[model samples]
Target: MADIDLDNMTLDELKKLQKSVNKAVDGYQDKQRKEALAAADAAAREKGFTLSELTGGQVKKTKAVSPPKYRHPENPEQTWTGRGRQPDWMKDALENGQSKEEFLIV
Candidate 1:
């Protein structure tokens, strides 16, 4: 709150003032963040769920990927789960007049 003339300050004084300002700002932000988190946790608890569950803040557990359902006709080693993008071999097969039903595992 002190109105000191910054122009009259030495280089070291200005640097010290900058550090103090930065430290104060960091401390203020940390306090605010903590308060916000506490409020969120309280609100979540009131709604019968933890803050992590309410806001999805917890690390998600990955589900096991399903086994491949379809296989290549030419090469039995090549297979697909029919989930994501098609493989190059599958694309080539399709291009060469091969029906997708021909590659079914069952």
Candidate 2:
């Protein structure tokens, strides 16, 4: 491979380079996810249940409601998937002598 002289590269060449880099990064992320899933499946087998048997449609049927949208910390005008949202009430409770990990089943 020849040296990529960025100063001499055209706009099209720069776009191609950017696309290639994004593709390589996405490939790495996909490989990591595949390895993690394989490990989970193997662990399930060691526990005397195959991945399919352990799942058995049980994992897919959650009845939880969708969480509310949250204002982004960096950009207040923007919103996020509340998977990482810390509501003000929850934060206050934790600050005032409460533990977030203390959920009780009815």
The local distance difference test score of each candidate is: 0.87, 0.68
Task: Please write out the lDDT profile of model 2 over residues 2-104, one tens digit for every residue.
Answer: 7879999899999999999899999999899789878988999899987777778453333877644544344455533346767665566568897654321
Off by over 4 Å in 2: 1-8, 56-106
Q: Estimate each model's TM-score.
A: 0.53, 0.43
RMSD vs true structure, all candidates: 12.9, 11.2
Best by TM-score: 1
Off by over 4 Å in 1: 58-106
The local lDDT score (0 to 100) that residue 46 gets in candidate 2 is 90
What local lDDT does model 1 show for residue 17? 95
Q: How accurate is candidate 2 locally (lDDT)?
A: 0.68
Clashing pairs in 2: none
Poorest lDDT segment (10 consecutive residues) of candidate 2:
72-81
